[model samples]
Target: MALKPFLLTMLDQATELCHRLAAHGLVVASDGNASIRTGSGFYITRTRSEFENLTVDDWRWMPVVGAPTTGVSSEWRMHQVIFHQLPQVGAIVHCHPPYATSFAVRGEALDGTLLTETADFGKIAVAAFAAPGSGALAKAVIDDLGATGSACLLQQHGALTIGQTFQEAVQRMERLERLAMVQWLVTAGFPAHQTHE
Candidate 1:
């Protein structure tokens, strides 16, 4: 079926956002995935496609009312679960940034309270570890989203953020990584470099 102009726009924007995130080191290679809810179901990036550069034709539409996603990303289940559980989330981003993934590997949730801007981020939850791309991982992410609305850190995997738009979720992912970096620096006693901004 031919996608409407709006859906095509979404595919373009999602592709751009995915590339931007990858350029920023927020997601590397095919370790992360992105998706946006569609009228019938949703459209996700192709399996094993590098999100760094996606064309308009790269999105695969999966119906929410039909058979389960067949050859999509292993974390396709994660997006599926989110769309099912939360009616409000329109876009989802899953990434494995270095600093954030470090915390995830250690099963540590972000303590976003040190900075006023990130105070609300303190509620970010860490979903328990499960085999990657498995139904168990999807359930764990769903449960973590239950504890917070903005974002969740996947145990031994990566980070996931939801937003009314894909851009908002990407921003959340950036903030989550920043918070992690600051916390890491503080724990390591690294002196804060003053920026002349």
Candidate 2:
């Protein structure tokens, strides 16, 4: 089926956001995935897609309720679960940002109180580890994200963020990584660098 202009625009924006994510080091190679809920289903990155060169056409549309298909990101199920359980979430981003993933590897959740940007999220929950892309992972993620939380970290894995728009989701991920970086620096006794701004 032909996608409407609005959907096409959303695809373009999503593609651009992926590039931004890559340029900022939030995602590398084919390491992360994103999706936007459209109508009854959603458009997601294809399996093994490199964000730096991702194109709008590279996204695949899958029904909200359907059998899993091949050639899509292994974590598609996680996106699907959020859409199904959190009716307000219109976009989802899953990535392994270095600092945030470090927290995940260390089995630590972000102290959302440290940064104004993160304060609203409170303490970001860290979901228990489950095999990547498996149903168990999906369930674990949704349980952590719950009905109101906007972000969650996957234990020993990565992080996930949801939003009413792709931009919102991407911003949350970026803020999350920044929060993690600040906490890491604090823990290491790295003196704060004075900013001219």
Candidate 3:
């Protein structure tokens, strides 16, 4: 099928974000996915595809108003719920970063109390545990979308972030992972540098 202009843009963006995820070690193999809304639908990375080697053919375009799950991410429900709830969001990126996943595994919040950078990214709440690809997980993510949160750590899972653009979503994911690392370092007895006048 011929790709629409918006979908074409989304494909390019998804490919870029996927490469970024792999290059920055935020995800391994086919562990992460990126998507962008085109019209009332979205273009997302295909399942089980490596982010670093994505191609135009690796994208699947689906209508946002449908529940069909033939060839989309296993977390499609969560993505759909989030994008539907946040009209301003144009892109979504989900990845499994080491530090963030570590915190998730421990059922800890990725809060700014650990570092200034975390504060800059706002507070990262750790959503309650929900089985992967389950409706429970989707609702858990929705509940975490309260105030002062742009990203959330899925307990025992990974991380999810949204943005006004593909680049913005990718940037948030990167920031979230960095904050996770800092949180780990601080909690592991490495004191963070204190800014002073």
Per-structure clash totals for the candidates: 0, 0, 0
Q: For residues 1-197, could you state the per-residue lDDT of candidate 3 as single tens digits?
A: 59778667767767877787889999898888778887787777777878888888887777777774478877777877777777887888888999889988888887765666557655677888998878899889889966445788899899988888888888888888888887777777565675678
lDDT of each: 0.82, 0.90, 0.80
Best by TM-score, which number?
2
Candidate 1 local lDDT, residue 106 = 90
Ranking by lDDT: 2, 1, 3
TM-score of 2: 0.93
What's the true lDDT of residue 167 in model 2?
A: 97
User: Order of all candidates by TM-score, from best down to worst?
Assistant: 2, 1, 3
lDDT (10s digit) by residue, model 2, range 88-169: 9899999999999999998988899998879998999799999998999999998898778999999999999999999999
Q: List the candidates' TM-scores in order.
A: 0.90, 0.93, 0.88
Q: Is candidate 1 or candidate 2 better by TM-score?
A: 2
lDDT of 3 at 105: 89
Candidate 1 per-residue C-alpha lDDT over 1-197 given as tens digits, one digit per residue, 9 for 90 to 100: 48788877878888898888988999877888888888768887778888776676767778755566555766787888888788888889898999989999998878878778778766677899998878899898888888357898999888999987889888889888888898898886565674677
Ten-residue stretch with the least lDDT total in model 2: 188-197
